[model samples]
Target chain A: MLSNLLVQLINGIALGSTYALIALGYTMVYGIILLINFAHGEIFMAGAFVGLMLVTVFKVHIIFAFLGAMLFCMIMGVIIEKIAYKPLRRSTRLAALISAIGVSIFLSNLANLVFGAKPTTFPPTEEILFKIQTYELIAGAQITNLQILTIVTSAVLMVCLQYFIKKSRIGKAMRATSQDYDTAALMGVNVNRIISYTFAIGSSLAAAGGVLVGIYFGVVKYNMGFMVGLKAFTAAVLGGIGSIPGAMFGGLLLGIGEMLAVALGLSSYRDAIAFGILILVLLIKPTGLFGTQIQKKV
Target chain B: MLVVENVDVNYGAIRALVDVSLEVHEGEIVALIGANGAGKSTTLRSISGLVKPNKGRILFEGSELQKCPPHKVVEMGISQVPEGRRVFPLMTVLENLEMGAFTRKDRANIKDDIDKVFAKFPRLEERKKQPAGTLSGGEQQMLAIGRALMSKPKIMLMDEPSMGLAPMLVQEIFNIVKEINQSGTTILLVEQNARMALAVANRGYVLETGQVVISGAAADLAKNEAVQKAYLGV
Candidate 1:
């Protein structure tokens, strides 16, 4: 029983890292533009499908497949922003949000038309990257190579993102844009470009999450983005919508909570419990666990 | 160095500025003074490319400014210390200063300029790692002015730099403004504090209800009967 719990903990973290990857996109885009890109989940789905095609059809290396998916999703994200959201930027927030939902619907249906509704599976791990092997962690607990890969990928990407936002010029501009759009413009930040960058980074990260999820679960579907998207959005809100570290923390916490729920024999109501936490967070700690704003006393 | 000729600006159905005209010469502190809702900020906004003029033109260094975006305007060496000291509040003081220089192309000189800013306002250096929002109103104002300076702008636009500050802080801000001008930066100052503005400005424009009702040397405007009564609290 103790080993089982440890195994669940590892699985939870692996799953949580994927959610964190996608959650970062939601939080960053929302932080900069105040528009929840509801279409983001579709981007994740597209990334998975793209990765599948790259591996099975193009017969490419797995690393290249992942990179290609991320690149494709980056361009797709920028185009979607330019076409769907940029026009409505000055309009009411609801208008932009509706546009996002419309984009989400349109993309999902397009994927459905192309890929069919049936779930597709990734090539077996040995056929692409490596042979599956498990290493014992504790008395009865064991960790798989794939789980280690997922956690490491997530950790590296998140660390890189944090460092970029703190040290790089464009990343700093992105932070400034999130803080104050007009003030950023006043400081000579091309806010339109920054918005495009936000979408690009968010979408790429989501795409990375998608590819990882596809490999880990060994399956991909046209509508797979729907449930995961909602979960990632929940994670973003749980972490505090505009805070980056909050999204990471929130995703891990949610992942652990969901795994524990499943371990307790509540698999059927997993989504219900996930969303229930979202409701609880909204009702109780609306500012979230890591509110970034430090207000000045005037 | 900057010219606004018969500019008109409207917000929906409301006429914010009607046939407004003003100019600022190189190396001079030009103050645009008026009462609240008198379109002082609108004129500055129009010049800074934040708002487009409905009619007329704005020329800076013989280049038309009606079409440039705010960042493009900054690229041409005009920076505004915007109203209310609108620093990027969550960013560290050093980061805020870096943002001010975002449009400059001389990447290598940015560090030197940052050091220059630190020299001008060493208090900012003391709080370089602190978030701008945590600073006192006076320090924030200094950060704002210091931030604008980081861009190496030829002319600086200052809007209500004394707002929400104590009297002593206001005096200090004005002194800093004067020093900035004396050190070869042209200033177009917008202030409701007519007395302080006139004291620092070489020339002044009195904007009343979207029109420039008076324009002359600062000393003359300060001595004018209507200006003394309406704005200067004589």
Candidate 2:
């Protein structure tokens, strides 16, 4: 029984890593502009479809396909920002938010039209990369190589992101802009370019998450982003909207919690459990577990 | 080095500045002093390109500045130490200083400028790793000024550098202002502390309701009976 639970826990972590990848995008964008890119889920879907096309049409290797998807989504994210969000930036937050939803609808429908409404099967990882291999653990528990890859890849990307934000020149500019937009501009940081970079990075990370999810689940759907995007957003808010580490922690927790519910014979209500935790966390700690209270200066 | 000519600014329906005009020449400390609603800050904001003027033009080193964006204005060799300091609260003192040189590419000079700033404000050097928010009000003000210095600006526009400080700290800030000016950067100062501003300034402009009501040498303005009664609280 303990080993069975442990296996479920490992599975939960693998799922959580993907969610965390998407959640980072949400949190970073929100931190900079305070606008929720509701269409981010659509960007994820776009990545999966792009990945599929790269593999099937171009016959690219799996690793290159994954990277190609990320690069494509980065451009897509920047284009969406320019077309939909940029003009409404000076208007009102509600206006920008409505625009985000509109873009989200437009992109998903565009994907549906291009990729069709049917669920497409991802190329088998065993055929493209290494064969599906498992390692036996204590108490006869098993861990797949794919699972290990997903977790490790997520960790490496996250660590790289953390280092970039903490140590790089542009990263310092991002932190300053997030803190105070006007002051950053006064310091000669091109606020517009920084905003564009934020969207680019966020979207690419979401794309990476999309490709990983497609590979793990072995099925890619036109509307796959909607549910996963919402869950990732929930994880972001649960971890504290603007805090980087908070989003990571929140995603892992949400993933594990959902899997545990399923393990406990509540699989049918997994979505309900995930959302219930969001509502509970909001009620108990609205600032989120790691969110700091914003102090308004006089 | 900087010129504002008959500029008018408005916020929605309200007129914030009416035909405001001011100037600061090379190697001079020019102070704009007035009451709370006298449009003092508006004049500085206009010069810094934070606000658009409906009429007239701003010339910085012989180039039009009226349409320039804030970042471009900074690139034009002007840096503003904004009112209330506006330090990035979460960033360390060193990081905040680094951000000041965002537009520059000279890495070695940037390091030298940082050292110069640290030499000027030793307290910041001591707490370089601590977040700016953790600094006391005086230290934060020093950080703000030090950060501005990192830009190696041709002219520095300081808005209310002495606001919300103890009398002793205010005096110390005024001394730093004089020291900075003597170090060859032209200064355009906006302050509510009329007496202190006039004391440090080479020339003074008294703004009332967005128009320049009085302009002359700072010593002359300090001695004017009308200026003393209204602004000096004498």
Q: Which candidate ranks first by DockQ, i.e. highest?
A: 2
Q: In model 2, where do residues sit more than 4 Å from their true spots?
A: none
TM-score of each candidate? 0.98, 0.98
- Interface RMSD against the true structure, candidate 2: 1.1
Candidate 2 root-mean-square deviation in Å: 1.2
User: CA lDDT of B85 in candidate 2?
Assistant: 93
- Candidate 1 lDDT tens digits, A66-131: 999999999999999999999998799999999999999998999999988898999999999999
lDDT of 2 by residue, A1-298 (tens): 6777778788899999999999999999999999998999989888888888898899999899999999999999999999998998889999999999999888888878988899999888877777899998988677999999999999998999999999999899999999888889999998999999999999999999998998999989889999999999999999999989998999999999898888888999999999999999999999888888655453
The parts of candidate 1 lying over 4 Å away from their true place are A294-298
lDDT (tens digit, per residue) of candidate 2 on B139-182? 99999999888888999999999999999999999999999999
lDDT of 1: 0.91
Among incorrect, acceptable, medium and high, the docking class of model 1 is medium
User: Across residues B209-230, which tens digit of lDDT does each residue of candidate 1 receive?
Assistant: 8899999999999999999999
- Per-residue error for B116 in candidate 1, Å, reads 1.9
